[model samples]
Target: MAQPTAATTTSDGYAEGRTDTETVSRTLATSESGLEVTVFDSIRSISAARWNEVVERSTCGSVFHRYEWLEAIEAGLGKTPRHLVVEKDGNLIGLLPNFVVDIEKTPFRRLSSSYPGFGGPLVTTDVAESLSLLAEAVPELCTGRTVVHQIRGLDTKYMRYNNYLQSEGYEPYRRECRFVLDLTQGYGEIYDGMSKTRRRGIDRGTDGDYEIVEEELTRPNLERFHRVYEQVMDRVDGDGYPLSFFERLLDMRERLLLLTIRIDGEYAGGFLELLDEQRSSIHGFFAAVPEDYFGDHASELLYDYVIRWGIDNGYDTYDFGSTNANFENGVFRFKEGFGGRILPILVWERGCSPLWKMLKAGRSLYWPHRYE
Candidate 1:
């Protein structure tokens, strides 16, 4: 049964997706483990304190798994939040944040822990047992709600998830790569590591013709950013993040930074950075500059500026985000120029309908970058 979800706030100032105080609890899996699994239809029913405690404690915990991000996802993307939590002896043990994504005009429906972000089940302790219960509770509790119930952003080093995934007959589907720049090294070394062309481009930004503007989230600033952003999306033949998405993102202003590059006091281009303290990383997200501004190497300068800022702020890594495995992709080549370690984009999936997976697989050959 589906529970009604209304936008509300928790006592701690986190966004809430439900008004009800009660949870749809179920005692699932082996009773021998003494762990109780409870499935939540709302983020409000679960205490933010307890939820964040597990997130902070788990090695796999990321900002995406944190309570606030889920709040933003619900508001920004308008996806209904779902969570599967586990407790043993009345103590919190595990959490998996999920949302229902139904593609408009299509039969595709999924229960994604996070649809477009990185998140997986997190446990405070007793990792093996907690993960077992969390994984097992999904199929029984989530059956028929969606065609697939999958988790994203599981690390390759954590074989426990892989072990359970195989045990439960879940399939590994998406294999992509993310670029991570090592920030432990000195600034000079980091700069030197970049391709010669990129280094020269960054230096060009210092030609006294460009300025980096850090502005407040006012209407004008946002409109200008979106203007450039829309053109960039059109240029790449990609869909731009809706204006409402960014509007809903205002809830995350404390952890978000919007920087635009100015060439002779004109808005040339900029990018938004998600300051992720949980991972000790700065992620390069939502960036754009006009083609006219390309000559000034504004894009390269944006990367250089953000990377320097991350280094000075003590962030351990700078992520260029993910791209396709294909070398021919221009985005991939652009990120490779900055000298970052390439790592696989791990996404775990379990589809209830083989027909859907089959059709998706066939479609994927034509659109390798898409997910069903």
Candidate 2:
């Protein structure tokens, strides 16, 4: 994506050149002293230093809550940010990085702390009080044709705010869960821990004489992954993100990895992993194996390669990403083969009342809607 052309400041919406901070007045949040909450339309407006301070100190913080991540969402995907900031005695205490998402071909718009990733309220102090403030401001952001405000799951490590969110009218549920493997052990131990079936997958894919090569973020490789991604999404009745988003993410190389399995010097399959440096973890964001290569166990090879990479790189855990909560799903079983513990993807959502469900019934629903 090109640099966004500057737009003049406006009363009703955000401006490119000006950073406007809109303050919300609230005297009390459940009898606690008032904490001043404000809004920034563009993350570019805020000091990246100050914003990151909150993330670094906050218990619930992750890379998804960082300024750069939110900025990418705004610039790459064309989502308008409604980043909320919290303060008490002039000290930055909390932040919620939400973007406005419009559901196509429907009358639904919503505010998501993250639409394609994991993030929620990041609070450094007075956790419950800050959460309450964010909770109150969230509904108000869902104005106009907007019908919902969803906070995607926080990383499993810091997803303990269920009660806090539930207190503020956000319902917590799980339709997806991420499989996490401990990567601090030696490769021998890690390999032995895997299910016998998974061991066979590694053997089979290895026998196919494929190589797991780390691919550079070049146009051809990206286009190849994008095509594979689109096919995977199509099979699930889903929509994959545009190539531009991957380009932006690739720029943050310190926190991202792109790897592909090649057979006979040709790309056969690949996967994308997003690194959370602060937490010492790697997340499997995207993976695709063409139908022709399915028998080769490219998916298993990709996971094995990432596991080795994560362990060698000193990452504490390697995530297999989210899968349908159903026990019968192939994806679930595939990830489970790696011998990892299952944990719920902690998500808090509000809105999507009965009317919206009745309105959106069937028709191949995607996320947020699928959860509804």
Candidate 3:
């Protein structure tokens, strides 16, 4: 049964049409802060001024949620996928841009963001209202369809609602952790706060006439990043997602930024970072450096350059991306030297098929490390 809305059935005691074909009117629900909720199908459907206002107010609102970023992802994909927007009193409040992906081409579908990771709902004082609206809207949008809605990299607060989704036959699949760096105090202070020894190493590496520049990822740079990326991937036997995937991303120049790190004319290292300048973040993507030269702390130099570049280019945060166990990886420890903090990410998913749901749940419980 659908949740009760403002409208009621006709006097004849019968609805006009079948639920599948029926046009259901949206009912405004009250937010914890006493705001009303509305949903939009596209960015053009919402007011830009109001949208920016909500982003400014929310902690999770960042450049990644920007229209330009979504457009670029769409352009890279060669088409736009379905988008969902939440508004209050004709003002933008939350946004979700997602596409359906096949798990293994068995007619099962999973919702995905333009990028691999996204925490869609705005970070508001009233997370319950925002989450409740999302939960209610999605099933309505899906209607008769049964599909897995994989909410990627969400803040831990939403985990409380996992049971609510599970009651609707959705399975909670996987959850992971992501690392982020705070860049609000400006780059200089950020650098000053780093561990003394690590800072000394980075300074020593760069003192011998070192320089960094944000270079266009032309054909040459792409090939280089790919080659180095292949080497890094080979170590883990990581399967490459596809070159065309990145090429398509690079094509959307307005929504993307590719920066290469060169040390004294040698290609020391490079990273393809997504920039949301308005939100002041440099999202970490592909990263590569020569393995042999790694001992020289070339990667650290590259990081220093990238963080500075992000700040200079008007970005305030440097997202360090995902990390495994805290002890094994020195990179995580190094990032902490720069005042990086860890953000918990949960992967909540609902399965379309009962068998599929069981299989996914078992795989998640038994073989968590392999999939991740």
Candidate 4:
């Protein structure tokens, strides 16, 4: 639990020379408490087993923090990975899997976590101490660079981390909420606890001829899911990930579950869920339903099936993902019908350069809707 100062080394594993932005290289940083932080430019440099070990042991770890998820993201999104691994006494303790994104036609850059859902560092123990060490090393990681560093904490456990970041001059830019259904109770009890309207929707959907099936995460299945997802996103005017993202997600099919809904042999809706067998938790990653079936309660049916699947599989929790807390949109009301509690998801950010601050201020003025 000692506070450590950071020192950096070059990509060739040397202790001298500066980091080059164009190349994928390694940088080593050490702290005063015998703590060493290594920046790996490639996901392959860290063993999956070792990285997942820290994730499985940490409270904030999720599917997005896994090594395979980052690999797939890099493959699909073409983002540069700048993953940090923290060690103490030659033993692995923490990890922060992040990516570098270059804004098109702009000199500004963003150093953000793998995705917007849930990321930061997965620390086995001494979370605060580990974070302090990581925070100290962040400046070195951003040396000779001008980028905005944004980290999100999805779990309430991250509030402590948020406090630390705030003390270190980071700003809480956005607030989001996520819903989680506890599966430890009986399904009957869970169903009975749902709102009357939600219960009716579930019953109606279940009584219909809609067929629900779990499909393998293959290219064809992913493509079909993406098609439906795109339709829904278009209807809502939401931003969608490229098809290559779903394609890469299929690469880790062993850790993913694809649930598709069919009505009269026609694909109606579907969702992709991430499975954490060790934690007995399932996270709702992405979903899509056509506008034609908006009133048909296709989403309710999907959630019902997913919840029952979790129960059947002996999973302990069903995470419904995040929603903007600033507005109680239709999506938020829809998820609230289920018997899940709302938990805050905080995003901590810091401006690394004058240009980034000016750009951020300009964005606030030009795009006021973003902050709303």
Candidate 5:
């Protein structure tokens, strides 16, 4: 993707000479709380120290907010996502990581950062102003003739795009709630915090009949994990499939960990997690169980072990990623059972002339359900 034309400060504020081709550009703007917005071709443009400092100041931010994870996503996933930084004169205030997602080979397109997961801008209390700047800037930067600005896994309260959608007749979007296990008090305190029944289940799995094993996906395990992943996907009636390339993605990135529940030597269920320095985030990646084991709570076994392992290893947070159901669904309920707190995700999107019309024409394709 081409970079935006040089930004020139002018009486009108800042005049970014329009680009001849389509692209997303980072610009410097003096905005709310005396902050300036800086755009990047990729998340790697910012140093890890600067990126993480902003995360530490934000409420829902975690170690997964580090630049290395963003770099891993970009390296493993073939998408060129851009990262935008909002600075206060010189100090960092906020971040908006976005990408230009093409529809395979079609003329269709959209802008996203971290897809299939709830990762948007991490900011202090300046959400409204930070989002407003993005709302106005997205349309101008898009290069696609018709692009759907897909703001993924958004927490509605802090977002600005919902207003635009309301006027545009897009209706309210879906809600997803994540399960987070808090580790402030120590693992023992956290373990005792669980309900007696859940505690028993974890203890029961320890009888050796159900072995909760933490294994990095070796070459053979990767192949086995893929087989189980495919079965789970098929059972869920899913399409727009996760490419086999993702197995390679996990291998290439080497940041992925596969936590599995083995029932007397059989692969009953599993969960995938992405680890950085201080946090292990559970990507709602994939899990599979035999029909007979559904009643046995193999899924719960997987969750419990992953959470326990994460806490024991001195990690600060065990993120349950996001779910399409906010107040409902077994996914959310099970995670909540572990005493997880809630955090809202937000997305801010704006469309350009050509892309807006195209999105309307191909609305179905532009807004298909995303299975990440």
Candidate 6:
């Protein structure tokens, strides 16, 4: 079993209390069994090769867990990272990509996973022990500073890890659903396997005058998509990231797929999906279209194009993003039509300080509509 040494502070100024000497000594220590865990203030400080190696070996790993993704978040969102790397016998074995959220004057100081997707620890088959050690180290890392420790992921694939967290006093909250389409069976079979209604929708969308064009991740193209995205968010009363977020994503063009739906050469709808070539999966991250185009099935055409692109590119699955399990709304219905299976995604959270209780009580008073 891996054992943790003394808790270390991050080199970045984000580590509020601890001094540099304390942090450096803690980082260099090892357990009796030669297991060591180090916390990094920035993803750039860690070896890309070593970090990605653990990601490649973990079953639940995704593009969101990649070093570049987290680096982008740091560069774009300005979130302070507290990335944990675990090693045994001098070999990297486990990783947890987390960030600290400490807004000025707000009583809430949270250490959480990256937004919009699965993020917890990605470990080897010896999941129980690796997670237990990491969990044990969390409290010390926070050191009475953070109010809450929150971990969110897209599926229950980490059932064992979740159970371990529960035993450690974490409350499992917000059960969401994710739709995934299996692409290993070949595109023809998968398309035929879809519900009759979905097939008809696709047929209509294909016959429509709209044309699907795969666009390069240019600033202008991203800006066009952002306009549609803003409109979609407005219609649904949803909050969105700044335009800079999409721009940062566009900067990492090699790892993305930007497909636009056009009606008579004018942009109508589109999706910005992430490509995980190593995992043979494509994640449908964000999509947008005018509310008037809902009936026109512009999204249907976009999805069809994305699925075909995945199949042609030899990907194994298409993740249609996440939805609330309690709400079977238009978004849920649209993704369900693809004949994808709905899986439960669990978010585990625990209040570590008294401020957390206060924050929960005054949640509406503080930020009423902000989706955490």
Please name the candidate that would achieve the greatest TM-score relative to the true structure. Answer: 1
- lDDT measured at residue 354 in model 5 versus the true structure, 0 to 100: 51
Which portions of model 1 miss their true places by more than 4 Å? 1-30, 102-106, 141-145, 154-160, 217-224, 368-372
Backbone clashes in model 3, listed as residue pairs: 280-316
Per-prediction count of colliding residue pairs?
1, 0, 1, 0, 12, 0
lDDT by residue (tens digit), candidate 2, 228-305: 888888887777787778777765766778898987677887998888988888988887777778788888888889
**Model 3 stretches with alpha carbons more than 4 Å out:** 1-60, 71-82, 85-94, 102-109, 113-115, 119-147, 153-174, 186-197, 207-209, 217-227, 239-241, 250-257, 311-314, 329-337, 368-372
- RMSD of each candidate relative to the true structure: 5.1, 4.9, 8.7, 5.9, 7.8, 5.7
lDDT (C-alpha) at residue 44 in model 3: 39
Q: Which ten residues in a row have the lowest lDDT in candidate 4?
A: 12-21
Superposing every Cα of model 1 onto the true structure, what RMSD results? 5.1
Candidate 3 residue-wise lDDT, 1-372, digit = tens: 143344465421223333322333344465566555543333433455666666567766665555554544544443323456565555556655565455543444455543554645553545556666666656543322335566664345456656665665555444345666666678778788778966887878776655566677676767777777778778766655455556755644554556555566777766777766555567786677667666667777877877777667666678877665354456657666666766656665655445654656655556446322
Candidate 4 residue lDDT tens string, 260-329: 9887677898988999776678989799988777567788899988999999989999989887664447
Q: Please report the TM-score between candidate 4 and the true structure.
A: 0.84
Better of 3 and 5 by TM-score: 3
- What do the candidate models score in CA lDDT, each in turn? 0.75, 0.76, 0.58, 0.76, 0.60, 0.75
lDDT of 1 by residue, 1-372 (tens): 344356565432224554455444345554576877777666766788988899888888877787777866766667666678888888888898888777434556777877667778888878777777777766653444366776777346444577677677677666567789999896889888999888888887788578887778766777788888999999888857777777766766777778999898888979988888878888887898888888888999888888888888899999998788667888888899899998777777776655556655665576666432
Candidate 2: give the clashing pairs: none
lDDT of 1 at 235: 88
In TM-score terms, candidate 5 sits at: 0.62
For TM-score, candidate 2 versus 3, the one ahead is: 2
Off by over 4 Å in 6: 1-29, 102-107, 124-129, 143-145, 192-197, 355-372
TM agreement with the true structure for every prediction: 0.85, 0.83, 0.64, 0.84, 0.62, 0.82
Give the CA lDDT, 0 to 100, for residue 371 in model 1: 34
Question: For candidate 5, lDDT tens digit of each residue in 1-372?
Answer: 354567554332323453424344456466646766767755655667888788767655543455655655565565566567776657777776766566545766666655634455677756768766655555554563436565554333334445654454333334455656676576687778776767676676565478776676676676676677778777776542344445544533455667777787777867667664433344444565555666566766786777667667766667767665544455666666676667644543445555565555565565454221
